[model samples]
Structures are given as structure tokens and as C-alpha cells.
Target chain A: MEIQRLSIKSLTITILIVIAGFSVLLSFVSGEYFFKAARESQLYSLNRVIQVATKEIMQQLHDQAYDIATALSIEGEIPKEFVKAVKGETKGELVKALDDPLITGFVGAYIIDLVKVRAYDLKLNFIAESHQGIQGLSPQMPKILYQQGYGRKGVARSKAISGLWQHADKSYYSVLVPIGGIFISGYLEVVVNPVNNLVRLSEKMNSPISIRSGIDPKRFYYEPKKSTEKLLPIEYELKTDLGASAFLLTSYEDIAKLSEGVKETVFNTISVFIGLVLIVLLIAIWLFQLLLFKPVNLMLNEIRNITDGDISRDLQVKGLAEIAILSGEFNKMTKEIRSREEVLTRLSVIDALTKIANRRKFDEVLKNEYLLGCRSGKPLSILMIDIDYFKQFNDTYGHLAGDDCIKKVATALKRSVYRPTDLVARYGGEEFAIILPDTTKSGERVIAEKIMSEIARLNIPHSSSSVDDKITVSIGGYAVVPSIHDDPVFIVAEADKSLYQAKGAGRNQFVLRNEFNSVI
Target chain B: MKKNYLISFIVFLLLVVSGIARAEKPFAPEKLQGTIRVDAEAAAELIVNTPSLLVVDARKEVEYSKGHIQGSVSLLDTEMTLEKLSKHAPDKSTPILFYCNGERCLRSSRAAAKALEWDYKLIYWFRGGWNEWVDKGMPISR
Candidate 1:
């Protein structure tokens, strides 16, 4: 099975995506933490404001209760009337005394909501209540009032006592004032409902406030209007003048809304952040393509052209510093390759010992020229030359001298050919051949005579010759107007045969044969 | 050898001075057992309501006369002998409240501890003491 590999482009994109994903996740987590912190701080401030407002309202209620208690206790006329009403044992008279204009007028002078007022005897038995419904005192009232130091003895000592009291369905803030001059009589109690004050408190604090009766859980008062969402049910047990235990429950939803706002801001910030990240990534990819990938691709194509034997042009230098340096280095490398290739090409065709075209080059040129001559109907000629008694010359002067003599002969023969189109090649050891592209039989004879004269002019010494005392060469020549049916090798064979004839006759002469087999 | 002796003498003098400084540091109160701790507000409330409550200023007579909570009587911790307490509070069941300068002062806690040892029925230790009372702007007497 083959596994697909990731390309650089795809890999870069994948890494960018991973980084973006991680950043988004980080933003989400931080946003959540920020929301939580903002929510907590909002709640804390809300709680503080509610506490201050509640304390102020409670203090106002306490002052009102104190004022009422002080007014009733210090007034000698009210205490005397209350004593008469109790002694007369007339319910109608006691009710009238309790609701007299002086007492009601004095109570009404304080503008706070005085829900109910009642009078109790020293034994804490019910005497008279201002509200319509008559009620007997709670059996636990005496014990609670005594424990709070607001009992009959407490009133005698402290002059007055105010406290909160809760029944089955109602809670009240009541002040107990002892009705006596020096000896204690019945008690005059003034009760006020705290719900109205709580309402004002709710408005001041901008949050919902309520009171729950600790003595009777069913009794709830001053509950704020209904809300969509409630938060932080802060319950504080109040230590007030009342004997009844009560608790205040307050909730603030604005803090929750503030947290929602924080979340919204966080989401918006994250969105903008992600958008910027994407833009940056795109720009980065574009820059990579422009500065690196494109330059690298151009360099790759240049290398391909070089391998394909088209190393004529150099690479263009451009782009960023590193890529430009790489391009320069690549160009230098291709130039070196081309120079080495030229040297190798030259070395492959030239004869190493004689500094002339070798046999292999000769064969390639002969084939190409023959084909050309056949098509053009041009007369092509070949000359074959041999060093006379070259082996005997070697046995006498040694092979080194023989080699020196051969070099001299090769040079002389090369000098004999005048036209640039003619070629001279070292045919073999002690042998040479020349190809002339456009020459007749007479022209071939002329070149062969010139080669013989040039070789004779060299005047090299050869000691062991059966013909002359110096080195000499035998030459053979052939010329023909090539036809399509003729082979180029046939010209070389004819020239070789002529060279055999020249060697057979003597050592120092030339022979030539024309296309029609006539000797010249 | 004389130079070595001189160095040793200097080292000994430094050690003695540091020891004296450590020993002269003021005493801090530790946790007290078998007592209920109250703040200035609760103590003031109790003093006002409970007639039998004895507010003992557990400092020296000079420190107590400088400033103290209203209705509180001076009763130094050093002078809180059994005979002295019995003379002031004939009934051992009377509520006794103790206080000093502040939390760092050990006099109030020590007096409360002595009262506990004497088997007083009710004991209240106002840890915030005279400093908190003045800070709260509560009524005080000199």
C-alpha cells in the first residue's frame, strides 16, 4: 500500500490551521474565565450596595419605633387613660381610649406606615389592638421578650423596648412602652409593618428585597415584583428590636446581565482575532510562494535544462537573499559542468600521441561526407599514407625515436592539406588518411604529391632502410563522384590497395587511382 | 592570639544584646478556652440590657482611667485575686465581661482565664477592647 506524502504547501497550511485552532481554543477559555470574574465582581458590588441600603432602611424603622415608644411613655395623660381603661373592664371604653384622638393623632404625626398598634397588660396578656381583628397574645411572647430584655421587667428598667414579632402569616415591628408613673401598669405597644420600607429599599438598591419569617417559615413580607432571573439569594438574619426572628433575602439579576455582556464582548473579540489571524496566514503563504517556492521552481527547471544538454543560458538571479544566493550557486555549478564537458569531448576525439584527429573521428567524418557527396553529386577523395620501413626504423632507433618520427610525419601531412574542408586523421600506428569533400582525380594527385614532398623535406634519419637512409613514406589516393549505391568504405579500401602497390614498387613514391579505375 | 580573643569578645557581646532584645518583645495573647468572644457592639448591648453584667477593664488603673467603655470598672489582671472578685461580685454566677487595649493585649484574655479558673458562670471576652470601642465612636468614660 502506498502512503500519500504531505507536500510543503499542504503541510504549511495544516500547521497554520492547527495554530489557529489552538488560539481559538485559548481565547474561548480565557473568555470564559473573564466572564466568570466579571460576574463575580458584579455580584460583590451589588451585594455591598444592597447591604448598605438595607441597613439604612432598618435604622430608619428603628428610629420611628423609638420615637413612638418615647412619646407614649413620657405622656402622662395616655398612661392614665390606659390605666382607667384597664381598671374599668369595659371593652368598648378601652377600645375608645386606645383609639382616642390624642393617641391616634400623636401616632399619625409620624408619617411611616404604622400597620397596627396594640396594648398589653403587665402579664403580657392581650388588652386592645388597633386593628379590627382581635387576637390573643402568643404563648411564647413572654419568654422571647424576656430573653431579648424587653419583658415587663425589661420595660421597667429600660423605660421602653422595641422589637420585631412574627405570627403565622404576618410580621411586625412593635415597641413596648410601660404605662405607669412610678409603679408599672399595663403596656402600650405600637406596631408598624416594615414591608413599605422594604419596598422603598428595593427601589433604592435597584434589586429585589424580601423578608422571611424565621419563626414561621410560611410568613413572607415585602417580596419584590417577579423577575425573569434571580441571582445570589443573599439571606441575612436581622437582629432588630422585634423579638421575632426574621431574615432578609435579596437577589440581583443585573450582575448576571453584566456577565452576559462580558461573554458577548469576548465572543466579538475572538471573532476579530480569528479574522486577523486568517489574514496574516494568507499573507504569509503568499510571501512564501513569491520569495521561496517560485524561485526554487525556476532553479529546478534550469537544472532540468542543463541535464537535457541545453546549457547555453545561465539562471536569472532574483528574489530573497537566500534564494538569490542559491540561484548564483546553481549558475556557477552549471558553468563548471559545461566547461568540464567541453574538455571531455575534446579529449575523446583527438589522438593522444600525435595531436591530430584519431581514426574514430575519421570514420564519422567519412560517413557523413559520403552521404552528403552522394546527394550533391560531388567528387570525394581519400588518401592513405604509410611510413616506409617504420618497423625496421623502430628496431634500429628504438620506439621512442620511432614515435618522434611519426609525430613529425603527421605534422608534415597535416601541413600538406590546404582547404579547411579537408580532414587529416591518424589512421593507425605509422599510417594516416585524409578526406577531401569536393576534389577530382587530378586534384587528389596534386595533394598526394604535396604530402610526399613535405615528408621528404623533413629529412629524418633512418639507419636500417633498404631504400634511402632517411625516413620516407608511401602514399595512395582514390577519387570519385559518389553515387547513392556506393559505400564510403570502398574509397578507403581502394586507397589502401594503391598504398600496397606503392609499397610494392618502391618505398618513396606515390600512387593514385581515379573513379573509373585508371591509374594516375 | 590577642586578635582572636578580641573577635570572640565582640561575638559574645552581639549574642547577649540580641538575646536581650528578643526577651524584651511585648507579649501577644494566645487562644483562650471555655469562653465566648464578643465584639464591642455585643458587649455594649449586654452592658445596657443586663443590669448584673460586670464590665471589667483588665488594664492597670492608670490605663483604665485614661479611657474606657461607659459603666466598665477597672480590674487589672494582676489584681484579680479571688477575694477581690468575690468582694465586687458576691454571686459567682454574675456575667463578667473582660477587655483590654486590643487583640494584642494579653491582660483581658488573662483576666478571663483567671475568671474561668475561679468557675464564673458566664464570661465574655471582648477581644476588640477599648481601641475598637473608640474606633466605633461608642460611648466611653474617662
Candidate 2:
């Protein structure tokens, strides 16, 4: 048994959905990789921002320290003791002057935020200094004077050396400025606190922050914790200039938001893609109905009609080429079946020996003609013919020769009737009949005489015949305008009686009569 | 017109009465653990004497810019974070002095205690703050 196939529409939808599902899966995997790339880029940019901010804060510190140092150098220009102290002409003169309340007043009045100021001589000797730089730090020649950046080349070009120096347990920048104008007699060191600038650096970070400096709990800094699940903490160690542990900078960035956004974007895109695929699926099924299924269904209906016995139905092929071809082939098959049926019908009503209408055909034609005569009130005629002595002819010439003579008599008798309305049949062995519609009494007699002459014309030898040594027939015919009261059997019976009368008179003769009182 | 004026006068009287009724002190509490309370004169001395002293104005930016200690750094108390406090005073032993709008503002008191809580040892809160400093005609930056 053949398994029922899935419908074309169902098959189309299934194929389309499978393709869409595969595409969605492929894109989802690719999207995951794309999200990974995006996360990596974000982390890269975040690291860059950290480096840039650190550099900015350090630069700002140098700039502030540089500004203070330049001011101190200019203010100290008025004091002749600075010049004297720089040339080694006076060892403590600049110190003494800077220590005076009046000189302190003048300088403090000039620079408001000045915390510490140190003046050095040409030979890098501690010449004079103010007291307010870093707490517990005494005035001394900066050891950085001998450092690489501040050595002979620096002194020659008058370049400044700068950095955050840890003095008195405090970190601050000390900037050096030349005391004299272009001649460079000495250098001034101005201290700038880095605490304020460093504290404000938290503003550069986008997330909540914490910074732990060394092992000291006091130096450990952080924002209050709000959520542990959403905020993922991360830390990177910042090494100091001396290569020791500087601080552990920690932060909790809300990375879930980014991942969630990526997921939502992927979901929305997949949904739209599926939606589009579904629309295409619907369109495909409809197109199959229009361009394929409908035409095939039409052909199926025509075949169904043919199965129900409407063999004359011709199909109108339509739609796609394959279905049209199928319909065309079906029409050809039906035409062949109809022609075969016609041939079978013809064979059933024909005689084997005579090749003419058999007894059954003669009876059917007689009944039809009688009914037509009843309606039209016209004369209907029939002639029954018998061989004079066919049994003797068969004994003399053998059955095959007798059958040949009967076939010849059947053909000649058929030729005697001209109209298509007439029917000639072999009623039985060695017997024949003819039906003529719309014939008068005289018309019946004329047809009977014509059939006798036509049969005699064959001239087949019959040595056993009582009348002559040639094949011959005696005919009996009757004509009448029949009515509803008369049966076609009565007409056939009357014609048989007439055949008996002719046979009784003698062989090779006919008696023709009409039941109607009206003559020809 | 006379009746309207009378009603206006009555409303004004009610406002005055309410103002007097709600004249509560704006000063922060006098005592606090983990901190040393000092005056403006002591604060000034700490600035000049201590080499490692960090003066902080624990007030809003607007208040600090109006008039604050000359060497003080503005670290707003309301906006203070441990990272910010530690960045200013990384060493626990560093002497950090805090001040705000005199006795009327509690920002300095809170900020000074917050510093000590972060393990800083020397947390000084100047109770007199800017008011006493101005009254004494001490040096001003602006």
C-alpha cells in the first residue's frame, strides 16, 4: 500500500521553516562571536581611558607645581640677599631674610596658596627656604639636584626636573625654577600637594570605584556597596615609581547591561527574521495553489467524472507545465477508451458468418420502426426470407459452401435496400429479414421483388434444390400503419404466416400484404 | 484696601512668629570620637607649624570658593568618598585638618570623623572655621 504523501503546501512550509531555523541558528552563533568582539573592544577602550586619566592627573600636578615655582622665583628677585646668598658671599643671608616676619608677610601676601618654598645657590647648596612645604620636612638641598634630568645638561639648558616626591610621609610635586632671569644664578623648589588632585581622579571612571594603597586600612578607599550580583568587582595593581605596591584600583562595572542589550538585539533580529520567513512560507503555499495544486485538482475532478462513466469529457489543461502535460496525457487515454468501447458495441450485434446485423439487431430495429410508425401513422414493412431447401444444399455442397452461399445472399439482399432507414439481418440459419420504415403496401411488394432478384443474381449452384440447381429464397412481407393497440411481435408473426403461405404455394416465391384498409 | 492691608500685616506677624519658633541651632555637635576639635587659631598654627599638614575645606564648592583657608583643598563632605579621602591623605599618620562654614555647618565635623574612620590618625576639625577666622581678621586667600 502506498503511504499517503504530505500535501504540497505542508511540504513547502516544512522546507521553508527548516531553512529559516538553520539560518537563525547560524546567525545566533555568529552574533555570539560578534558580542564577544564587542566586549573585548570595550575592555580595551576602558584600559586606555585609565592610562590617559593617570597621565592627565600627573601632568596637572607638574603644571601646578611649575606655576608656584615660577612665582616664588619672581618674588624672591627683589631681595638682594638671594643674589648674595647664591654667590656664596653670605651663607645665611637669604635664610635670615626669608625667616623675617616682614619678608614672610610680603611673600605670603603675594602668593596665597603657597605651602613651601626652597631656594638653592649656583653650587646646589641649600641657601634659604620658607617653612611651609611638607610637615616635618626640614629645608635641605634636594638630592634630585644630582639626578640625571637635573644635572649638568639641565643646568646648562635651564630645564626643570619634576615628580611627586615622598617627603614627611606625604606625596607632593616639587618643581625647580632658576632664581636669576636668563643667567640662572640659583633654583627655587616649590611644593604642590597631590592629595586634592588624586582624590578628584575618581571622576574619570564611569563606574563605582575603590583604591587601596599598600597594607594600611586607612589608605584603603572605596564606595559603598549597593549590589553584589549586578556589580562585578575588578582590580588592577598600580605600581609606584619605586616599583613597590602603589595602590589596588578596584571598580564594579555593570557589564550585565551590555550583555543584556546584546541579547535583546539578537532576539529582536531573530524574531524579525522568523517573521519574514513565516510570511514567505504563506506566500509559497498560496503560489503552489495558484500555479500547481489548482491545476492538478482540476485534472483530478475530470478523472473522477470519467470514472463515473462520462467518457466524452475532454480536459482543459492549465497552470504549470508538468501539470498541463499530465492533463493532456489523461485526455488522450480517455479518447482511446471511448473508441475501444464503440468497437466492442459493434461486435456484440453483428453476425459471424454473414457479417450483418444478427437476429437480435433485426428485432431491435423492428420494434423501433413499429413505434415510429405508430406516432407518424405511416406504413412500416418487414420481409422474412428462407432458402428453399438449405438442408439439401448443405448436404450437397457441405456446410462451408452453404455458409458461403448465405453470406452472398445476405450481401445481395442488403444491396436491394437503398435507404439508411432500412435494416438487413440474418434472422437464423439460412434465413434473412429486412425492415423498411415509411413504406406503403406497394412499397413493401417492390422491396420484396427487388430482394428476390438480388439473391437470385448470386447464382450459387444448389444441385439438391427441389425447384432449381441454384440458390434461391421465398419471402413473406407485411405492411401496416401501426397503433398503440398493436405490438411489434404481431407484425413479425404476420410476416411469418406470409412466409408459410409462400413456402406452401411452392419454393422461390413471396406474398406481400398490408393490414391497413388503405391501398398504395 | 484697608482690610487687605490688615490681613497682610497679620500674615507677616505669623511669619515672624514662625521664624522665631524655628530658630534652632545650626551648629554640629561639639563632641565626636576619633577626632580632635580645635579653633581657627589652632588650625592656622597647624598650617604653618606642621610640614605635612593638609588643610581641607569640607564644604560645598560654592561655600569654599566664597572664602576658605588659603591653603585648604575643597573636599565636599556630602560628596566625600573613601577613595577621595584616601587620595588626599594616603598616610594614616598625616595630619589632615577639616573646616567648613564655621559652627553653623556640620560638614567639617562629619568629614573629620570620616577621615579617622578610614584609619587616618590625626583628624582635626576646626570648629570656628571661616567665621572665627574672619572675626579675628586672619589672612584670607581671596
Q: Give the alpha-carbon lDDT of every model.
A: 0.75, 0.72
Q: Candidate 1 DockQ category?
A: incorrect
Models 1 onward score TM values of 0.56, 0.55
- Residues B1-142 of candidate 1: C-alpha lDDT, one tens digit per residue: 9999999999999999999987665554555688889886677668766889888999889988766765678889998898888877889899999999887688899899999999998999998888877665343454
Q: Model 2 lDDT vs. the true structure?
A: 0.72
Which is the leading candidate under DockQ? 1
The number of clashing residue pairs in model 1 is 4
Write model 1 residue lDDT over A1-520, tens digit each, in one string: 2335755667777787799889878888888888788877877776777778778877788776656655554454556656776786556655665555334465354546665556667776667665333255443443345454343343233345566666555566666655542235666666666766766766786667666666655667656567636555655555444434565545545555666678889899988988888898888879877877777777778778777878877988578998788888888888998899888887777899898889998999999999999889889999999999999999999999999999999999899999998999999999999999899888888898888889889999988988888888998889888888988899999999899989999868888898788888
Q: What is the lDDT of residue A336 in candidate 1?
A: 92
How accurate locally is residue A154 in candidate 2, as Cα lDDT from 0 to 100?
27
Q: What is the lDDT for A64 in model 2?
A: 56
